[model samples]
Target: MKCTAVLAALAAIAITPVNGGPIAYGICQTGCNAVVVACYAAAGFQFGTVIAAAAAPATILACNAALGTCSATCATVALFAPIP
Candidate 1:
């Protein structure tokens, strides 16, 4: 059991940034919102509303590219799994 715990800890460390770096929001998150709004803006929602919905929090897991892999700092492990 102890060995398993140690291995889990090591894996966690391996995915983390050395000093807790900042991450940028994925472009897809923004782009999807833009496209949706552009396609349906006449339905009552304004461009600003779409922009507001697309706006990410001040702090978010920024996507980073590293040696053919994605290395990112995020609030949750699940957040790090997907590239976008």
Candidate 2:
């Protein structure tokens, strides 16, 4: 159990962004609101007003590449992973 806990913590740390690191927001401002919206939409969340509320940050992050905000090598793994 101790080992499992340690591993989990390490995994979390691995995914966390580094200070001064560049994270792509895909053409949106800080926090990548636009990319988050698109990601949510592509994930099939497009519907009513709730869509905006639901897909805000996530969509922005998804579109980070387009925005040229995130680093290609570092953000690649985290960006592709399912929303947390």
Candidate 3:
């Protein structure tokens, strides 16, 4: 039993890649969401609303790119998973 507990503790330490905690996860998601909202607002589009690439301004495209990068980073660090 004691050996199993020691192994579990070691595993936990081995996996934490950053200052992993609830606060970090919340901050990561909040920041990512803010970027998306700001981008959408700038383009005169709100959340859940989509516009065609050809019709939308360059800001929309840049927003999408930023969102992708943000999501990937958050998942890898905070969630400990890939954006699959």
Candidate 4:
């Protein structure tokens, strides 16, 4: 269960687009790393609680913003979630 959650979080991070250009992508990656770290720090190595408490909000926000604000095609590219 924990492994599955971690894998899903990793997959989500892989798909999310950074806010800016290449540099922004790097920063976003760093931010994602921080988030992951925070989750682990708070929840220990249990992937389900960590990911649910941390990544879910960020992911949902990104997905919603991408869907509502972006153009249709752009939203499709930006928030390509497996579940939504």
Candidate 5:
């Protein structure tokens, strides 16, 4: 009986749509590495790509502000800046 219930729960999770996406939690500047880690874990499988994509606009804006010499690496650094 217990095994059946556990299996049912697992099946429910397996079928659930992943909608949470990338979730940015807490303040990075204040050093919420733990929270950031937790949020990334909870953000689920595709978060790496989702997060990068979501952060793209801000990165572009910063790049433009800097006079059009934006490298993705540089933009990414600012995109996830602790104090930004």
Candidate 6:
């Protein structure tokens, strides 16, 4: 299911802070990366352009916010370790 990628991307935006080690860092990196990508994909950027570019501004804006939020999450996780 290709659509399953972003199925819960937005809902998974909020992540709790947890003191973790290597494994946690790996999960954080992978998880946050996936969420951020899914956020953009949900915003219709996956195709390299906006599909309904002007159809729903709110939805696209929400996705944009989600992108920022999820990217912040990635930054937060980066502090967890060297997520490179």
Q: What is residue 82's positional error in candidate 1, in angstroms?
A: 4.7
Task: Quote each prediction's TM-score.
Answer: 0.24, 0.22, 0.55, 0.31, 0.21, 0.37
Models ranked on TM-score: 3, 6, 4, 1, 2, 5
Kindly indicate the candidate among 2 and 5 with the higher TM-score. Answer: 2
Residue-wise lDDT of candidate 2 within 1-84, one digit each (tens)?
122233335446655544322232121133334444565577566523443534456654444444344233224433333222
lDDT of 6 at 48: 33
RMSD of each: 13.9, 12.8, 11.6, 14.5, 18.2, 9.3
Residue 46 in candidate 2 has what lDDT? 50
The local distance difference test score of each candidate is: 0.32, 0.39, 0.62, 0.40, 0.33, 0.50
The residue pairs found clashing in candidate 6 are none
Model 4, span 39-84: residue lDDT tens: 5445345333433535455554444344333233323332433321
> Which parts of model 4 are misplaced by more than 4 Å?
1-19, 46-84
Least accurate 10 contiguous residues by lDDT in model 2: 19-28
Looking at candidate 5, the ten consecutive residues that score lowest on lDDT are 21-30
lDDT of 3: 0.62
Q: Higher-TM-score candidate among 4 and 6?
A: 6
Give lDDT tens digits, candidate 1, residues 1-84: 122233345446665453321222243233334444443543444434334434533221121121012212222332333221
For 1-84, candidate 3 gives per-residue lDDT tens digits of 122233335446664444445554565677788879888897888855775768667888788888878766665565532111
- After superposition, the stretches of candidate 6 with alpha carbons farther than 4 Å from their true spots are 1-56, 81-84
Query: What TM-score does prediction 4 earn?
Result: 0.31
Off by over 4 Å in 2: 1-31, 47-84
> Which segments of model 5 are wrong by more than 4 Å?
1-31, 45-51, 55-84
Top-scoring candidate (lDDT)? 3
- Best of the candidates, TM-score: 3
